[model samples]
Target chain A: GAGVSQSPRYKVAKRGQDVALRCDPISGHVSLFWYQQALGQGPEFLTYFQNEAQLDKSGLPSDRFFAERPEGSVSTLKIQRTQQEDSAVYLCASSLRWTGGTEAFFGQGTRLTVV
Target chain B: SQQGEEDPQALSIQEGENATMNCSYKTSINNLQWYRQNSGRGLVHLILIRSNEREKHSGRLRVTLDTSKKSSSLLITASRAADTASYFCASPTQGAQKLVFGQGTRLTINP
Candidate 1:
Protein backbone atom coordinates (compact mmCIF):
# COMPACT_ATOMS: atom_id res chain seq x y z
CA GLY A 1 0.00 0.00 0.00
CA ALA A 2 1.06 3.60 -0.53
CA GLY A 3 0.44 4.46 3.11
CA VAL A 4 -0.70 3.03 6.40
CA SER A 5 -4.37 1.98 6.43
CA GLN A 6 -6.77 1.60 9.38
CA SER A 7 -10.07 -0.25 9.27
CA PRO A 8 -13.51 0.89 10.37
CA ARG A 9 -12.89 4.60 9.98
CA TYR A 10 -15.54 5.11 12.66
CA LYS A 11 -16.87 2.83 15.37
CA VAL A 12 -19.54 3.43 17.95
CA ALA A 13 -19.58 1.00 20.85
CA LYS A 14 -21.74 0.87 23.91
CA ARG A 15 -19.97 1.17 27.20
CA GLY A 16 -18.43 -2.12 28.31
CA GLN A 17 -18.48 -3.49 24.77
CA ASP A 18 -15.26 -4.84 23.40
CA VAL A 19 -14.08 -3.49 20.06
CA ALA A 20 -11.18 -4.33 17.82
CA LEU A 21 -9.39 -1.82 15.57
CA ARG A 22 -7.14 -3.00 12.78
CA CYS A 23 -4.18 -1.44 11.09
CA ASP A 24 -2.46 -2.40 7.82
CA PRO A 25 0.88 -0.74 7.63
CA ILE A 26 2.87 -0.09 4.49
CA SER A 27 4.48 -3.21 3.15
CA GLY A 28 7.92 -3.93 4.60
CA HIS A 29 7.68 -1.23 7.23
CA VAL A 30 9.77 -2.39 10.18
CA SER A 31 8.41 -0.17 12.90
CA LEU A 32 4.72 0.12 13.78
CA PHE A 33 3.15 2.37 16.40
CA TRP A 34 -0.29 2.82 17.88
CA TYR A 35 -1.46 6.07 19.45
CA GLN A 36 -4.61 7.41 21.04
CA GLN A 37 -5.70 10.98 20.43
CA ALA A 38 -8.29 12.48 22.73
CA LEU A 39 -10.49 15.39 21.78
CA GLY A 40 -8.49 18.59 21.34
CA GLN A 41 -5.21 16.91 22.22
CA GLY A 42 -2.22 15.38 20.53
CA PRO A 43 -1.73 11.68 19.96
CA GLU A 44 -0.47 9.69 22.93
CA PHE A 45 1.77 6.72 22.35
CA LEU A 46 0.09 3.42 23.18
CA THR A 47 2.51 0.80 22.00
CA TYR A 48 5.34 0.08 19.60
CA PHE A 49 6.50 -2.85 17.52
CA GLN A 50 9.71 -3.72 15.76
CA ASN A 51 9.00 -6.43 13.25
CA GLU A 52 7.11 -9.11 15.21
CA ALA A 53 8.56 -8.14 18.56
CA GLN A 54 6.59 -5.98 20.97
CA LEU A 55 9.28 -3.98 22.63
CA ASP A 56 7.15 -1.36 24.33
CA LYS A 57 3.67 -1.51 25.79
CA SER A 58 4.22 0.91 28.62
CA GLY A 59 1.81 3.47 27.25
CA LEU A 60 -1.18 1.13 27.20
CA PRO A 61 -3.55 2.87 29.58
CA SER A 62 -4.87 -0.22 31.38
CA ASP A 63 -5.26 -3.95 31.28
CA ARG A 64 -8.31 -3.51 29.05
CA PHE A 65 -6.15 -2.23 26.21
CA PHE A 66 -4.28 -4.79 24.16
CA ALA A 67 -2.40 -4.69 20.84
CA GLU A 68 -0.68 -7.24 18.70
CA ARG A 69 1.14 -7.54 15.39
CA PRO A 70 1.18 -11.23 14.71
CA GLU A 71 2.79 -11.40 11.28
CA GLY A 72 4.74 -8.17 11.51
CA SER A 73 2.65 -6.65 8.72
CA VAL A 74 -0.82 -6.18 10.20
CA SER A 75 -1.78 -5.11 13.69
CA THR A 76 -4.86 -5.06 15.88
CA LEU A 77 -5.84 -3.02 18.94
CA LYS A 78 -8.51 -4.58 21.09
CA ILE A 79 -10.15 -2.76 23.96
CA GLN A 80 -12.19 -4.79 26.41
CA ARG A 81 -15.03 -3.29 28.39
CA THR A 82 -14.62 0.03 26.72
CA GLN A 83 -15.25 3.05 28.88
CA GLN A 84 -16.51 6.46 27.92
CA GLU A 85 -13.06 7.85 28.58
CA ASP A 86 -11.72 5.41 26.01
CA SER A 87 -13.54 7.14 23.22
CA ALA A 88 -10.93 8.74 21.05
CA VAL A 89 -9.25 8.51 17.65
CA TYR A 90 -6.95 5.53 17.49
CA LEU A 91 -4.09 6.18 15.11
CA CYS A 92 -1.65 3.78 13.47
CA ALA A 93 1.71 4.77 12.08
CA SER A 94 4.63 2.95 10.50
CA SER A 95 8.17 3.76 9.59
CA LEU A 96 10.77 2.07 7.46
CA ARG A 97 13.08 1.73 10.43
CA TRP A 98 13.02 2.22 14.19
CA THR A 99 15.23 5.27 14.18
CA GLY A 100 14.74 8.77 15.44
CA GLY A 101 15.52 10.26 12.05
CA THR A 102 13.09 8.11 10.03
CA GLU A 103 9.79 9.63 9.00
CA ALA A 104 6.61 7.90 10.09
CA PHE A 105 3.58 7.54 7.81
CA PHE A 106 0.20 7.69 9.52
CA GLY A 107 -3.17 6.21 8.76
CA GLN A 108 -6.38 8.19 8.63
CA GLY A 109 -7.22 6.77 12.09
CA THR A 110 -10.29 5.04 13.51
CA ARG A 111 -12.61 7.26 15.51
CA LEU A 112 -14.05 5.23 18.37
CA THR A 113 -16.98 6.42 20.40
CA VAL A 114 -17.95 4.65 23.59
CA VAL A 115 -21.35 5.73 24.70
CA SER B 1 2.29 11.96 29.68
CA GLN B 2 3.30 14.46 27.01
CA GLN B 3 6.90 15.58 27.22
CA GLY B 4 6.53 18.67 25.10
CA GLU B 5 4.32 21.71 25.71
CA GLU B 6 3.38 23.97 22.82
CA ASP B 7 2.84 27.67 23.51
CA PRO B 8 -0.19 29.63 22.28
CA GLN B 9 -2.85 26.99 22.43
CA ALA B 10 -4.54 28.78 19.52
CA LEU B 11 -3.52 31.37 16.98
CA SER B 12 -5.57 33.22 14.39
CA ILE B 13 -3.71 35.06 11.68
CA GLN B 14 -4.52 36.69 8.38
CA GLU B 15 -3.52 35.09 5.12
CA GLY B 16 -0.07 35.92 3.74
CA GLU B 17 1.12 36.60 7.29
CA ASN B 18 3.66 34.39 8.93
CA ALA B 19 2.72 32.08 11.81
CA THR B 20 5.12 30.86 14.41
CA MET B 21 4.61 28.25 17.16
CA ASN B 22 6.97 27.33 19.93
CA CYS B 23 7.50 24.07 21.79
CA SER B 24 9.39 23.29 24.94
CA TYR B 25 10.41 19.84 26.09
CA LYS B 26 11.49 18.44 29.45
CA THR B 27 14.13 15.95 28.39
CA SER B 28 17.08 15.70 26.08
CA ILE B 29 16.16 14.32 22.69
CA ASN B 30 18.05 13.11 19.70
CA ASN B 31 15.62 14.77 17.30
CA LEU B 32 12.52 16.92 17.27
CA GLN B 33 9.81 16.66 14.61
CA TRP B 34 6.74 18.72 13.75
CA TYR B 35 3.42 17.35 12.56
CA ARG B 36 0.18 18.91 11.37
CA GLN B 37 -3.31 17.50 11.74
CA ASN B 38 -6.46 18.51 9.91
CA SER B 39 -9.99 17.90 11.20
CA GLY B 40 -8.40 15.88 13.97
CA ARG B 41 -7.50 13.07 11.60
CA GLY B 42 -4.15 11.66 10.69
CA LEU B 43 -1.05 13.71 11.34
CA VAL B 44 1.16 14.89 8.48
CA HIS B 45 4.88 15.10 9.02
CA LEU B 46 6.21 18.60 8.44
CA ILE B 47 9.88 18.99 9.35
CA LEU B 48 12.43 17.44 11.67
CA ILE B 49 15.47 19.01 13.31
CA ARG B 50 18.11 16.90 14.93
CA SER B 51 19.56 17.94 18.28
CA ASN B 52 22.90 18.73 16.70
CA GLU B 53 21.36 21.03 14.11
CA ARG B 54 20.25 24.53 15.00
CA GLU B 55 17.79 25.14 12.18
CA LYS B 56 16.31 23.70 9.01
CA HIS B 57 14.06 24.99 6.23
CA SER B 58 11.83 23.24 3.75
CA GLY B 59 9.81 25.20 1.26
CA ARG B 60 7.69 27.57 3.42
CA LEU B 61 8.45 25.85 6.72
CA ARG B 62 11.35 26.73 8.97
CA VAL B 63 12.21 24.79 12.15
CA THR B 64 14.67 25.67 14.90
CA LEU B 65 15.96 23.54 17.75
CA ASP B 66 17.67 24.85 20.85
CA THR B 67 18.93 22.04 22.99
CA SER B 68 20.13 24.39 25.69
CA LYS B 69 16.64 25.69 26.32
CA LYS B 70 15.09 22.40 25.29
CA SER B 71 12.80 24.28 22.98
CA SER B 72 11.88 24.40 19.28
CA SER B 73 9.92 26.70 17.04
CA LEU B 74 8.07 26.19 13.78
CA LEU B 75 7.61 29.15 11.43
CA ILE B 76 5.25 29.01 8.50
CA THR B 77 6.01 31.80 6.07
CA ALA B 78 3.29 33.32 3.87
CA SER B 79 0.55 31.32 5.47
CA ARG B 80 -2.50 30.39 3.42
CA ALA B 81 -6.01 29.35 4.33
CA ALA B 82 -5.05 25.80 3.60
CA ASP B 83 -2.36 26.06 6.26
CA THR B 84 -4.98 26.14 8.97
CA ALA B 85 -4.43 23.09 11.12
CA SER B 86 -3.24 21.93 14.54
CA TYR B 87 0.50 21.74 14.78
CA PHE B 88 2.36 19.51 17.24
CA CYS B 89 5.95 18.92 18.16
CA ALA B 90 7.26 15.47 19.06
CA SER B 91 10.47 14.39 20.66
CA PRO B 92 11.92 10.95 21.07
CA THR B 93 11.86 9.45 24.54
CA GLN B 94 14.77 7.65 26.14
CA GLY B 95 13.79 4.65 24.02
CA ALA B 96 14.59 6.66 20.88
CA GLN B 97 11.80 5.08 18.83
CA LYS B 98 8.75 6.18 20.78
CA LEU B 99 7.90 9.85 20.30
CA VAL B 100 6.11 11.94 22.90
CA PHE B 101 3.95 14.69 21.45
CA GLY B 102 2.79 17.97 22.92
CA GLN B 103 -0.78 19.25 23.29
CA GLY B 104 -0.39 21.16 19.98
CA THR B 105 -1.24 24.63 18.77
CA ARG B 106 -4.36 25.29 16.76
CA LEU B 107 -3.42 27.61 13.89
CA THR B 108 -6.09 29.32 11.84
CA ILE B 109 -5.33 31.37 8.78
CA ASN B 110 -8.17 33.76 8.21
CA PRO B 111 -8.46 34.91 4.63
Candidate 2:
Protein backbone atom coordinates (compact mmCIF):
# COMPACT_ATOMS: atom_id res chain seq x y z
CA GLY A 1 0.00 0.00 0.00
CA ALA A 2 1.11 3.56 -0.60
CA GLY A 3 0.18 4.49 2.94
CA VAL A 4 -0.69 2.97 6.27
CA SER A 5 -4.14 1.36 6.27
CA GLN A 6 -6.53 0.76 9.12
CA SER A 7 -9.57 -1.53 8.99
CA PRO A 8 -13.19 -0.76 9.95
CA ARG A 9 -13.07 3.02 10.01
CA TYR A 10 -15.77 2.98 12.65
CA LYS A 11 -16.82 0.55 15.36
CA VAL A 12 -19.50 0.64 18.05
CA ALA A 13 -19.44 -1.90 20.82
CA LYS A 14 -21.31 -2.62 24.06
CA ARG A 15 -19.66 -1.45 27.25
CA GLY A 16 -18.37 -4.87 28.12
CA GLN A 17 -17.70 -6.14 24.65
CA ASP A 18 -14.32 -6.73 23.16
CA VAL A 19 -13.20 -5.10 19.94
CA ALA A 20 -10.22 -5.51 17.69
CA LEU A 21 -8.70 -2.91 15.36
CA ARG A 22 -6.24 -3.79 12.64
CA CYS A 23 -3.47 -1.90 10.88
CA ASP A 24 -1.53 -2.61 7.71
CA PRO A 25 1.62 -0.57 7.56
CA ILE A 26 3.49 0.46 4.49
CA SER A 27 5.59 -2.22 2.85
CA GLY A 28 8.82 -2.99 4.72
CA HIS A 29 8.36 -0.22 7.22
CA VAL A 30 10.57 -0.90 10.19
CA SER A 31 8.59 0.95 12.82
CA LEU A 32 4.86 0.95 13.61
CA PHE A 33 2.91 2.83 16.26
CA TRP A 34 -0.59 2.93 17.73
CA TYR A 35 -2.23 5.90 19.34
CA GLN A 36 -5.57 6.86 20.84
CA GLN A 37 -7.11 10.25 20.22
CA ALA A 38 -9.98 11.44 22.36
CA LEU A 39 -12.38 14.10 21.23
CA GLY A 40 -10.62 17.48 21.08
CA GLN A 41 -7.30 16.02 22.13
CA GLY A 42 -3.99 14.98 20.64
CA PRO A 43 -3.13 11.42 19.81
CA GLU A 44 -1.84 9.57 22.87
CA PHE A 45 0.78 6.94 22.40
CA LEU A 46 -0.47 3.41 22.99
CA THR A 47 2.25 1.04 21.80
CA TYR A 48 5.13 0.63 19.42
CA PHE A 49 6.51 -2.17 17.30
CA GLN A 50 9.95 -2.67 15.78
CA ASN A 51 9.26 -5.43 13.36
CA GLU A 52 7.60 -8.32 15.27
CA ALA A 53 8.96 -7.12 18.59
CA GLN A 54 6.69 -5.18 20.91
CA LEU A 55 9.25 -2.78 22.30
CA ASP A 56 6.99 -0.54 24.28
CA LYS A 57 3.57 -1.11 25.86
CA SER A 58 3.83 1.42 28.67
CA GLY A 59 1.23 3.65 27.05
CA LEU A 60 -1.50 1.00 27.06
CA PRO A 61 -4.15 2.37 29.43
CA SER A 62 -4.98 -0.88 31.11
CA ASP A 63 -4.56 -4.62 31.10
CA ARG A 64 -7.53 -4.98 28.81
CA PHE A 65 -5.78 -3.05 26.10
CA PHE A 66 -3.47 -5.29 24.13
CA ALA A 67 -1.64 -5.02 20.81
CA GLU A 68 0.32 -7.44 18.66
CA ARG A 69 2.30 -7.43 15.45
CA PRO A 70 2.84 -11.07 14.86
CA GLU A 71 4.09 -10.77 11.32
CA GLY A 72 5.78 -7.35 11.66
CA SER A 73 3.74 -5.78 8.87
CA VAL A 74 0.19 -6.21 10.19
CA SER A 75 -0.77 -5.22 13.72
CA THR A 76 -3.86 -5.62 15.84
CA LEU A 77 -5.08 -3.68 18.85
CA LYS A 78 -7.61 -5.46 21.05
CA ILE A 79 -9.58 -3.92 23.83
CA GLN A 80 -11.42 -6.12 26.31
CA ARG A 81 -14.35 -5.02 28.47
CA THR A 82 -14.60 -1.73 26.73
CA GLN A 83 -15.74 1.22 28.76
CA GLN A 84 -17.44 4.40 27.71
CA GLU A 85 -14.20 6.22 28.35
CA ASP A 86 -12.57 3.91 25.85
CA SER A 87 -14.44 5.60 23.07
CA ALA A 88 -11.88 7.37 20.91
CA VAL A 89 -10.22 7.33 17.54
CA TYR A 90 -7.49 4.73 17.22
CA LEU A 91 -4.67 5.75 14.93
CA CYS A 92 -1.93 3.76 13.24
CA ALA A 93 1.34 5.12 11.93
CA SER A 94 4.39 3.63 10.27
CA SER A 95 7.85 4.88 9.51
CA LEU A 96 10.35 3.49 7.05
CA ARG A 97 13.08 3.89 9.62
CA TRP A 98 13.23 4.34 13.38
CA THR A 99 15.63 7.24 13.36
CA GLY A 100 14.79 10.31 15.40
CA GLY A 101 14.57 12.56 12.37
CA THR A 102 12.22 10.35 10.34
CA GLU A 103 8.55 11.20 10.09
CA ALA A 104 5.87 8.57 10.37
CA PHE A 105 2.93 8.38 8.00
CA PHE A 106 -0.53 7.96 9.46
CA GLY A 107 -3.70 6.18 8.41
CA GLN A 108 -7.31 7.24 8.60
CA GLY A 109 -8.11 6.33 12.17
CA THR A 110 -10.80 3.98 13.44
CA ARG A 111 -13.41 5.76 15.52
CA LEU A 112 -14.46 3.47 18.36
CA THR A 113 -17.66 4.10 20.30
CA VAL A 114 -18.33 2.14 23.45
CA VAL A 115 -21.98 2.33 24.32
CA SER B 1 1.96 12.60 29.40
CA GLN B 2 2.34 15.11 26.56
CA GLN B 3 5.76 16.67 26.12
CA GLY B 4 4.61 19.55 23.93
CA GLU B 5 1.99 22.25 24.54
CA GLU B 6 0.57 24.28 21.70
CA ASP B 7 -0.61 27.85 22.17
CA PRO B 8 -3.77 29.52 20.85
CA GLN B 9 -5.95 26.42 20.80
CA ALA B 10 -7.87 27.93 17.92
CA LEU B 11 -7.14 30.59 15.34
CA SER B 12 -9.46 32.16 12.78
CA ILE B 13 -7.82 33.98 9.91
CA GLN B 14 -8.78 35.07 6.44
CA GLU B 15 -7.26 33.48 3.40
CA GLY B 16 -3.99 34.98 2.14
CA GLU B 17 -2.97 35.94 5.66
CA ASN B 18 -0.03 34.36 7.36
CA ALA B 19 -0.72 32.02 10.28
CA THR B 20 1.64 31.29 13.12
CA MET B 21 1.35 28.58 15.75
CA ASN B 22 3.67 28.07 18.71
CA CYS B 23 4.61 25.07 20.77
CA SER B 24 6.66 24.57 23.95
CA TYR B 25 8.11 21.40 25.26
CA LYS B 26 9.61 20.35 28.59
CA THR B 27 12.46 18.02 27.68
CA SER B 28 15.29 18.03 25.20
CA ILE B 29 14.44 16.36 21.93
CA ASN B 30 16.38 15.01 19.01
CA ASN B 31 13.88 16.58 16.62
CA LEU B 32 10.50 18.25 16.44
CA GLN B 33 7.87 17.59 13.77
CA TRP B 34 4.74 19.35 12.60
CA TYR B 35 1.70 17.48 11.32
CA ARG B 36 -1.65 18.56 9.90
CA GLN B 37 -4.95 16.76 10.20
CA ASN B 38 -8.17 17.42 8.36
CA SER B 39 -11.67 16.74 9.69
CA GLY B 40 -10.49 14.21 12.23
CA ARG B 41 -8.83 12.05 9.64
CA GLY B 42 -5.27 10.89 9.26
CA LEU B 43 -2.39 13.24 9.89
CA VAL B 44 0.06 14.37 7.24
CA HIS B 45 3.65 15.21 7.99
CA LEU B 46 4.30 18.87 7.29
CA ILE B 47 7.85 19.66 8.36
CA LEU B 48 10.54 18.81 10.83
CA ILE B 49 13.25 20.84 12.54
CA ARG B 50 16.15 19.16 14.20
CA SER B 51 17.30 20.35 17.59
CA ASN B 52 20.49 21.69 16.10
CA GLU B 53 18.81 23.50 13.24
CA ARG B 54 17.13 26.83 13.88
CA GLU B 55 14.89 26.96 10.82
CA LYS B 56 13.64 24.95 7.86
CA HIS B 57 11.35 25.64 4.96
CA SER B 58 9.08 23.48 2.84
CA GLY B 59 6.99 25.09 0.16
CA ARG B 60 4.84 27.68 1.94
CA LEU B 61 5.62 26.30 5.36
CA ARG B 62 8.40 27.56 7.59
CA VAL B 63 9.39 25.97 10.88
CA THR B 64 11.71 27.27 13.57
CA LEU B 65 13.13 25.62 16.61
CA ASP B 66 14.67 27.20 19.72
CA THR B 67 16.36 24.45 21.62
CA SER B 68 17.54 26.89 24.25
CA LYS B 69 13.98 27.90 25.02
CA LYS B 70 12.56 24.47 24.31
CA SER B 71 10.08 25.99 21.91
CA SER B 72 9.11 25.84 18.25
CA SER B 73 6.82 27.68 15.89
CA LEU B 74 5.23 26.97 12.52
CA LEU B 75 4.45 29.66 10.02
CA ILE B 76 2.22 29.22 7.01
CA THR B 77 2.57 31.91 4.39
CA ALA B 78 -0.20 32.82 2.01
CA SER B 79 -2.69 30.64 3.74
CA ARG B 80 -5.77 29.39 1.89
CA ALA B 81 -9.15 28.04 2.91
CA ALA B 82 -7.80 24.62 2.06
CA ASP B 83 -5.20 25.14 4.77
CA THR B 84 -7.88 25.03 7.45
CA ALA B 85 -7.11 22.11 9.68
CA SER B 86 -5.61 21.15 13.03
CA TYR B 87 -1.85 21.43 13.37
CA PHE B 88 0.12 19.52 15.97
CA CYS B 89 3.72 19.54 17.18
CA ALA B 90 5.36 16.30 18.16
CA SER B 91 8.59 15.33 19.89
CA PRO B 92 10.07 11.94 20.38
CA THR B 93 10.05 10.76 23.97
CA GLN B 94 13.40 10.21 25.60
CA GLY B 95 14.58 6.65 25.11
CA ALA B 96 11.34 5.73 23.41
CA GLN B 97 10.25 5.20 19.85
CA LYS B 98 6.87 6.93 20.11
CA LEU B 99 6.41 10.64 19.62
CA VAL B 100 4.48 12.69 22.16
CA PHE B 101 2.09 15.20 20.63
CA GLY B 102 0.67 18.45 21.84
CA GLN B 103 -3.05 19.15 22.03
CA GLY B 104 -2.87 20.99 18.67
CA THR B 105 -3.96 24.31 17.20
CA ARG B 106 -7.15 24.44 15.19
CA LEU B 107 -6.54 26.77 12.28
CA THR B 108 -9.46 28.16 10.29
CA ILE B 109 -8.71 29.94 7.08
CA ASN B 110 -11.82 31.76 6.06
CA PRO B 111 -12.44 33.15 2.61
RMSD values, in order shown? 0.8, 0.7
- Candidate 2 lDDT over B6-84, as tens digits, reads 9989999999999999999999899999999999699999998888899999999999999999999999999999999
- Candidate of highest lDDT: 2
Q: How high is each candidate's TM-score?
A: 0.98, 0.99
lDDT against the true structure, each candidate: 0.94, 0.95
lDDT for each residue of candidate 1 in B1-111, tens digit (9 for 90 to 100)? 999999989999999999999999999889999999999579999988998999999999999999999999999999999999999999888755698899999999999
TM-score of 2: 0.99
Off by over 4 Å in 1: none
Give the interface-residue alpha carbon RMSD of model 2.
0.8
Poorest lDDT segment (10 consecutive residues) of candidate 2 chain A:
A95-104
Docking class of 1: medium
Instruction: Please tell me which predicted candidate would have the highest TM-score against the true structure.
Output: 2
| TM-score for chain B of all predictions | 0.97, 0.98
Q: Each predicted model: what fraction of the native A–B Cα contacts (within 8 Å) does it retain?
A: 0.64, 0.79
Residue-wise C-alpha lDDT for candidate 1, range A39-106, written one tens digit per residue: 99999999999998998999999999999999999999999999999999999999998787877889
